[model samples]
Target: MDEFAFVDRSKTNAEKYVLRQKLFGTEEVMPLWVADMDIATPECVLEAITKRLAHPIVGYEIMSDSAYEAQIEWFATHHDFVMKREWLSYSPSVVASIGCAIRAFSDAEDEVIVMDPVYPPFYSQVRENNRTLVIHTLNQDEEGIYRFDLDRLSTQTSEKTKVLLLCSPHNPVGRVWSYEELSALCRWCEERGIVIISDEIHCDLVYAPHKHISTARIIPENTVMLLGPGKTFNMAGFSISTVCIPSQLLRDKFEIERKRVHWGDGAVLSHIGFEAAYREGRGWYYKLIAHLSQNAEYIDKTLSSTPIQYAKPEATYLAWLDCRALGMDDRELRKFFVKEARLGLSPGLSFGKEGSGFMRLNFAVTSQTLTEALEKLRGALQGDAYV
Candidate 1:
């Protein structure tokens, strides 16, 4: 696997690499913002795409049954969740799938509940669809472990509340919800008739001692799981995701809205890549997880001496840094990282007001890149300017 070495993405159209200037107001900062990794995509995925391009002509494409079956088999083999072929549907992306579900399941002015300090799109998709965005802010302990505020959620949900957008093996704060936690949530939502759009995109990336429980496993009847190989195999550019709606009625409604929007399956190469990723990318996937775990440990050890504090992630490559001890407001904190540390990171405030004193760092880069970024950060924090 050649250690899946760092691939320079600056020359490519990768958002994390190329859009640094536009996003952070400077291209000089080391980018550790966007979720995608700096490592190369799995060889199997690349091989599949390459083989497809050998054909003479490109034409319109339809998703093949084999692709769907491959995904079904992968999930069953990996997560112990069995999926029927009929329950699956095509989505261009997880965010796109959420938008469609919001439109299909809820009406304008309907309320959609989300855990605050979540993925930014969870906020945007609800508001953009003209739905009332209800927030249940997650509570964090002194130890930095985050837990869902079920008591607050109980009060916040009402008759108008229609959907709950869940990020399992959550992003940023990275607490993979436990089975007990999921069971309670499922019971709560089931009583209120709230449908869950479980974004398990990061499920495959969970670390040791923390297990990822698919909400569908607990309550498949009311769950629509948004999954894809994009995050697991680093194929986001392909723009392919899957929506698993086990309920026949919900599936019918989602399909109607999906077709109405004219959002169809991706190109020919995307299908090939998707299947190849699920079927042949297992070995590479395990290696990537090991690499990511090492990076997380490195960050933990590096940041311990500084004012910044990080709770080792339970899942996902993103590390949420607690910058509150630095006493800088969001803007100043962002500037400090950009100008002082020369690092471009996703400002915590972008996730939600609850995220104000933190920043999300993508540690999916090569070990060499991660080490350098950490050293730069360490020097910046120790410098007299920051002191």
Candidate 2:
């Protein structure tokens, strides 16, 4: 808790930095926009970094066997999944890896399919690579739950659809996909010979009663699963990410491009953090999840009583709030909260066209922070704009 306390405080500090920089020199709102947690690094991670710092020699380092083992063992023990060292390829971050994969395997004009309202970076990667962006928006029921439309995806996939960027336990929506959904998705891509790049960064931080189904575990040969401790351990600034490609041929192809673009180095601390987090920090992770789960429940209850309604998240600290009851556009709604409520949140449209009228809130802060933000949100809803 002590370690993560600093992280939590840093969010407020970031908000202060932005708020203090106005032309009028007036301070503004608290920021809960970024997906990063307010919690500090776990004690085990801090001890590792501290020990590394004491060495006084932060030099270029090779990826360690223990680092790989740490991730391998964590998967086997926690998710009933096993990974081979041969499949492990290092990347500085997932976004870089996504770009590398597209450049390595697909042509300039090939299509990269991603679910709409996905992590916005996915959209950026596809477009930036000069590839066609094929978005198949998820279907939502009347109750506001998102459902996978396999038929829609199948109709979209073709020979030119060479890649599908899959977000397991999806962001913004916080759905821990079922085994059936994953299997069906893999089969869909497999039939079309589309490569599957599964981003499972949030797999480790899942809330209880919802199991994270790793796509590669079910269909290892065809999928490349991306996993890292950065998001799980609140170490995103460290920028350590891993790509598990079961096929050696595919791994070699990715490596050729990853090295050419220099996406495979300079995250020494993230590697150390990853090793320590997986090897020696199980207890801390358990406690962290317990606290985050409590926070999710509190938001669920708070939103239920207010005009805004949130589907209780099955995984991830992000809450997908349905603010459609207020009948406000995404931009106006976002500004209303930022100004009136004094709370900063991620606007839904930033995720995708499908995210309009919704907002994504980070609930990984302290309970006090969560309470204060919710109160402000309530006040914002009662403003004349909403009235």
- Best prediction by TM-score: 1
- Runs in model 2 deviating more than 4 A are 1-27, 384-387
Candidate 1 TM-score, C-alpha based? 0.97
What digit string (tens of lDDT, one per residue) describes model 2 on residues 1-387? 322353435345444235433521234666677777877778899899888888777788888988999999999998998888888877778888888888877999999998988899999999999999999898787876788798877777678989988888799888888898888888887888888888898998787778998888888878878888877888787878899999887888888887788764556777788899999989888988988888888887877878887878888889888788888887678767766777667788888998998888888888878887887777776663322
Tell me the TM-score of each prediction against the true structure: 0.97, 0.93
The residue-by-residue lDDT of candidate 1 on 1-387, one tens digit each, is 236676877788878878998988988999999999888889999998889899977788899999999999999988889999999988889999999999999999999998889999999999999999998888887776888877878888779999999999788789899999999999989999999999999999999988888788899899999999999999999899999999998998998999998977778889999999999999999899999999999899989989998878999999999999999999999998998999999999999988999999999988889988988888888773422
Q: Which segments of model 1 are wrong by more than 4 Å?
A: 384-387
Checking candidate 1 for backbone clashes, the offending pairs are none
Poorest 10 consecutive residues by lDDT, candidate 2: 16-25
Scored against the true structure, residue 367 in model 1 reaches a CA lDDT of 86
